[model samples]
Target chain A: MWPGPADPVQDLIDNFADLDSLVRVYPLLLQGFGLTILLSIVTLPIATASGLAVAVAYSTAGTGVRRMLVVAIDILRAFPVLVLLVLIFYGLPFLGLRLNAFAAAVLAIALNNTGYFGEIFRAGIEAVPPGQGEAAAALGLHRMRVLIHVILPQAIRKVTAPLASNALELVKTTSIASLVSLPELLRSARVAQEQTYNPTPLVAASLLFFALLWPFARWVARLERRALATGH
Target chain B: MDRIAENYFNGAVIAAALPAVLRGFGITVLVSLSTIVVGISAGLGLALLRCAAIRPLDIAIAIYVDLFRTLPQLVILVFLYFGMPYLGVTLSPFVTVVLGLGAVLAAFSAEIIWSAILALPPGQWDAARALGLRPVPLLFLVVLPQAVRLATPLITNRAIAITKGTALGTAVSLPETLGSAQSAMAIMANPSPLTLAAALYLLFFIPLVALSRVLERRVARAG
Candidate 1:
């Protein structure tokens, strides 16, 4: 009566928000959800630490070494995370280094994230006034001690917003691991959708992602606004 | 080193795969450009509508922006390409990628543009009004240009970042650069096409990255 074949609302409900299929797919989605979180937790620290280390080296290195580091960072940053993932996952076997899908996803994402975090750390470090370093040096602090103890605290504070933003990006980026069959949340949803001949699982997965990420997104937005207000 | 070059940088495999990779590069460029155009325009429209400050409309726009911002583009693409058919609405992979990435980009750009508009001095609006410019004319002639200028660097960065999602089109088999390269790698039993694809991506994106850096510096100087 309402349309050509059936009610549009009912069709949408059955296709998108069907509770029965959602319930059936919940277990698989839960497993994938855990893996997604695990991937983020594992990759974030490795990326951040190595990226910070690079930024430190860049600050201390000679001009030639600094130029080489900048070139490498730019190339890595310019490379698409997904292509890097594909390259690591599919292209690495040729070099006789085979990684499983999960390891490849983590490594690829870490590499990409490091490029970004390195740039952020460099900017943050640069933002600190030179006087601060001189003051630390005049107090007989070693260069590394000044950087680690005095300079880094201020640098990290200045860049917290960007760091959080990049972390959020990393969490979202984990979904791409699905493409290489890592059985993450998105992949699990796809499997369930195929099995049930329904899209409800996909909808559920998106809801899960939103539920996990929305708060973080809002926090990043708030941090950005505050940074803007502070004239950063 | 020599073996690495032979395996990944094979001259013959690259030559064999060049045509398909080029075709895919074309699709990648088409998708990226279409996404940029759609995203920027739609975003501007949404931001303009937002300027009206109607309560329900503002709420709806906020929800749209937040929802799109929260969901990953690949999830949206997968939903549109694979899930929509169950509801009797099907989009081709190309449309799906464009629509998904474009929608996400639109959300981000809308927020950036809206913030830029808000950041404009109130005096600008008052001056436009005093000059006898009607609301639409004031917005178009005075307000929007400033807002667009303020928003340009940010919108450019976000656009580049989101448009990189074009690589995700491989998931739905859109046969863009990465997809074609993957297929070539499979067929030629070498990863040369992937290497070539990486080089192509680097060539395209490095300039944009450098441009973003320049724009960022400009903004910092202006501040």
Candidate 2:
């Protein structure tokens, strides 16, 4: 297809950057990309809210409740998110609770992130000085009001950096949804690569991820730097 | 409950799957250990080189670190294992998993150690220089130890996370823990092997998770 005999550079272009294959797979790639974004959007809030709930419970609960929370968090954290996803996607049906691929992926990821975000939120809550709550109570605020109106806002702000970092992690992790036949971006690229016998789609998908994620990564770094400079 | 036990926790299936799963776990250990060695050393090496701080080299290293940080390990593995054959550089599944994960871990380690070095008070360098220690002696004796201590907790957490990615090797058909259990499931037509695999992973990783907590506490206290 080249005007002259093929060279190494031409071979690489054909193999990894073949425009014809890229065009063919572009629609499938877009569909998968949309699902990836959808998964991330759906997961982030559920994980953050649920994790916040868990953290708040830990803070206010009795020792038994605290112990149970810790055990649950530790177990979830110990299992690699991939393994957790597999267990849920495959093992749930045996118990007669069948979840579709998207639901299964969301459940597994949300569960995993709940553990991580719980810890992050717990740390954020603890970082709020005790005086903040005392002063709120002194002002006649109810305990729940003190927690919601005073402490939580500051706690979430304090944890903004880790929150963003975890969010980035969640987006990247959506790739694993492909493993369960979810046809997310990575899976779509795999399908395209197989169908076209060219790997260009994989490269294109990677570049797409890098483009989507790099700015947020840089933002997280800046946040981290600000957090470090401000110091606790 | 009985049905759940029969499908997922059957004793006979567990016993039958145990041997293959154990063999796969052995491979997991091998791959993880070797990847750790390669990753940490290469990471430390890159961090050390970055300390020298030539502009072009620093930019190149930054790009490498950022690229790896952003790309998922699975994507990298897929590229290397499947795409690279087209470029005349096919890698075995074992090599691909090790190299792919090692590269990612190295990126993280480099960042952690670099930041740890940056976190060190400048006085240490000034004091070491005043003592007549050369750059090499100064870095090794004075700077690196403190930086490494600071970096250790973060690095340990990241290493555990990345090494757990050995299960990702199943994508390339590396017969690691997850892969073996999967095939065993196929042969036995039972999901019990997967249960065994999860148990095995929990057995290996839960302690490490607990240890990381301890390390985080110790480091915080020391600081």
Candidate 3:
């Protein structure tokens, strides 16, 4: 009887005019947002460190090891992040290793991000010239010293923008954890929507996500533009 | 060994679930192809509009591109599928996935195509104008072919990445590859269906990934 599609304008207003519900769901959404941020915060460092290690190993490994590593990274990259999550969460129990939802999500996403970041790091490393390494060796610097002093600094500089972009992507991906029943932003939004039979919570969640991610997205865009301007 | 086989790698479970998974694969391919086609066509149109340099229209297109590009794909999918019914509009799951993914694909494609157009040497435009070609015909006849060629490798790569997003349809219960596998696994109580699903995904995407790689190398060499 009330705004049942007959009055389209009124219908639109009624759908979104629920400030009380919006305010009610705010704390729950914020809590979920906090967890999303924490997930990314925990993931970034682990992914970066492991990615660097994998890149370094790839560079120095023998042919067999290099081949194996390349194949593994390829498979990881090829699988969708969601599929990887499902595989790790569901498949691991069969192997007699069970993980809580949070742990499983972190492990799966971090592993996937490692593949991407390792590739970026390798490209950055390869972008450095062979002449620089040889010149350092000629100067009697030990191999490790040469790497730390001459190589890694430049490689890190080259890869920073890409690494930042990957971090942002990791942030967005943390939402997938909700599918495994983690009460992250998306799941919280779903819960609110079901509870109130209103979509305002979903809209609020989207706005929160945009607020959280838009600045990073713009920053990454600026970094890319600056890199391009510098002819990198 | 038998217990391990029964729980994780049960052959009977895989054989039972293979047909449903295959059907889901068909749906995945169809949805992906439909999205790609719609996305590319819409993207080309947007690129054309942007190239015309109409101020207000360009601003609107820019906003559309940025919004789709910045937001998570799942957010859009959930909003369209789950949130729209509240507003008195209902979209089937298939249409929802297509529209959601198509919009994203359009944003990327528009950027790529627009850049390709910009990268064309200015002299080509001048030359065509000197030959008495109007802007519309010149853009369609002289410029689009070369721009599309330049954009092909990038477009293909983006297509592969976005097409993988078809799996996100599973979130809406679309019964695509991942969804069918999840349901099958739930029914059989064995994880082998998931193993099968993973293999099917690999079988479907690995070739496209490799092809994109080759296309990238070819484009680089051509440049």
Candidate 4:
């Protein structure tokens, strides 16, 4: 749901185009920026872990388990991250599960990422020639060992570029936590926007977002270049 | 007993959601259609410029691609949507999102199309020039057609990018499927409608994802 039209930041800017008011909100914006990064950092590992588990479950689950996992992942992928955050943060309390807005937003977004990333990892595993997997099995490698040794190294390499892009997506998504008043980057900017009536200050945070993502893209490109150079 | 009751509630919510959900579907379809159209045109223009023999122009377009492709769409939308209003440039949320997202899609598509263009046999361009097809017509008719053949799957992926990208709409409070669902759920006491909303989104996303995959295979076959 949209925020109420308090527009505190906008008001601040409207009342004074002075750099002073904008500067005053700098700390708030910084806090938001810090929180946004923290959320993404925390969410990434959780998402990757959950995603790995789900991928395993999808691969190893019996027909019934696989079907259930597929349906769950399908639903998760289809569900909007923002809407789910709202539901979990606001609606779940009535169901006796309670998380504050920050926790709820992170949980929801991380859960959403898990579905797609799980599928990505699953696809990565599937892309490994079955012969390799069979060879591992013949060597007496347990399924777990086979996966750890033969599949994951290659899969991690395969997914690195997409995972980098996914990280960019997750960074943008943490902004939605603002909707439930999580005091994130956008939330801080929204606050400043209402207070100052000037969104130019938000331009700073946007630049930071761009700054944070640009390196990841370059890193992915660098990885691709190295892979091509090595002909791997 | 609880299962029966829950199913009945779900049925009612589904019935209620049918019209609005269809409207949501309509919006997504339109967004997808317009995005592909506008996106491809911009993408083509960009790819042509970037892949042009002119070094300066190529560098400029490369920078554009890098800037937009690297950043997340929501952050850009926020800048366009909430940031522009203070400058006395007001756009409705829907327009803000569509254009903002269309720009990002164009940025990525340009790279995909440019690579596809580069992949074509240089002989094709040579033959076109020999036929006196001239620069513009040759690029449009001979060059782009082949580029489209190669770019089709990537373009479809761009389409999925835009489709999934609409989730960013919720960031700007656009009443798309997810937004409408959230507001509706807020008003309703039960989660049944949220459940329905999730189902409807799958009905949209799954097909798009699957179609892109199929299209990718087809393009590979054609290639």
Report residue B136 deviation for candidate 3 (angstroms): 2.3
TM-scores of all predicted structures: 0.96, 0.95, 0.92, 0.83
Off by over 4 Å in 1: A1-5, B127-133
Q: Write the per-residue lDDT of candidate 2 for residues B156-204, one digit (tens) a residue.
A: 9889878888888988989998889888888887789999999889899
Report the lDDT tens digits of candidate 4 across residue range B110-175: 877776676677999999999999788998999889878776766776667566767567677676
TM accuracy, model 3: 0.92
Which is the better candidate, 2 or 4, if ranked by DockQ?
2
C-alpha RMSD over true interface residues, each candidate:
1.3, 1.8, 2.4, 4.7
Candidate 3 segments exceeding 4 Å error: A1-6, A156-162, A223-232, B1-3, B119-132, B216-223
| Highest lDDT scorer | 1
Candidate 4: stretches off by over 4 Å: A1-21, A61-68, A221-232, B1-25, B119-138, B141-143, B171-173, B215-223
Pairs with steric clashes in candidate 2: none
Give lDDT: candidate 2, residue A87. 81
What does DockQ give for each predicted structure?
A: 0.75, 0.62, 0.53, 0.40
State the lDDT of candidate 3 residue by residue for B1-223, as single tens digits: 8877887688999999999988988999899999999888899999999988999999999888777767888888999999899877899999999999999889878877887787777899999999999988999999999889878876897788779889899999898998898899889878898888889888888788778757845753464
DockQ of 3: 0.53
What docking tier does model 2 reach?
A: medium
lDDT of 1 at A4: 42
Clash pairs (backbone) in predicted model 3: none
